[model samples]
Target: MEMQNITLSLPKPILHRVKILAVQRQSSVSRLLTQAVEKMLEEETEYEMARRRQMALLAKGFNLGFRKPASRDEIHER
Candidate 1:
């Protein structure tokens, strides 16, 4: 994979905290940020994929109206 350089401006306090965290974890700030971004992107991708699948399934055949509606007896049994 190709590497890209990214520069971010952060508050001094936040930067100090990040440095402490990096030291405790024994990881560079760049690696930590990269990992965090990758994780969030992966999670967002899954959410998008799931939403698309749900929309597609709904479009094919989904009923908003009730069919063979359950009676109060059915709900009370559980």
Candidate 2:
């Protein structure tokens, strides 16, 4: 994978906290930032997929609510 470098500025207080975290974890600030970004991206992708699935099903008039036991079993069988 290609790598790019960019500069970011953090508030003095936040940067101080990051330094403590980096020392505890024995990781560099950049590494911690990268890991944080990766985790957030994974969650975002999951949210997007779920949203699309909901839209598609709702387009077919599926109400995302509880139903009586009989109606629930009927939909599951199909």
The C-alpha lDDT values of all candidates are: 0.91, 0.90
Q: Counting only residues 3 or more apart in sequence or on different chains, how many pairs clash (N, Cα, C under 3 Å) in candidate 1?
A: 0
Residue ranges of candidate 1 with Cα displaced over 4 Å:
63-78
Per-residue CA lDDT of model 2 for 1-78, tens digit only, reads 676899999999999999899999999988899889999999999999999999988888856696666767787895
Among these predictions, the greatest TM-score belongs to 2
The regions of model 2 sitting more than 4 angstroms off are 63-78
Against the correct fold, how does model 2 do in TM-score?
Answer: 0.74
Tens digits of lDDT, candidate 1, 1-78: 899897899999999998899889999998888888999999999999999999999889967786897789997996
Deviation in angstroms for 39 in model 1? Answer: 0.6
Q: Which candidate tops lDDT?
A: 1
Worst 10 residues of 2 by lDDT: 62-71
Candidate 1 weakest ten by summed lDDT: 62-71
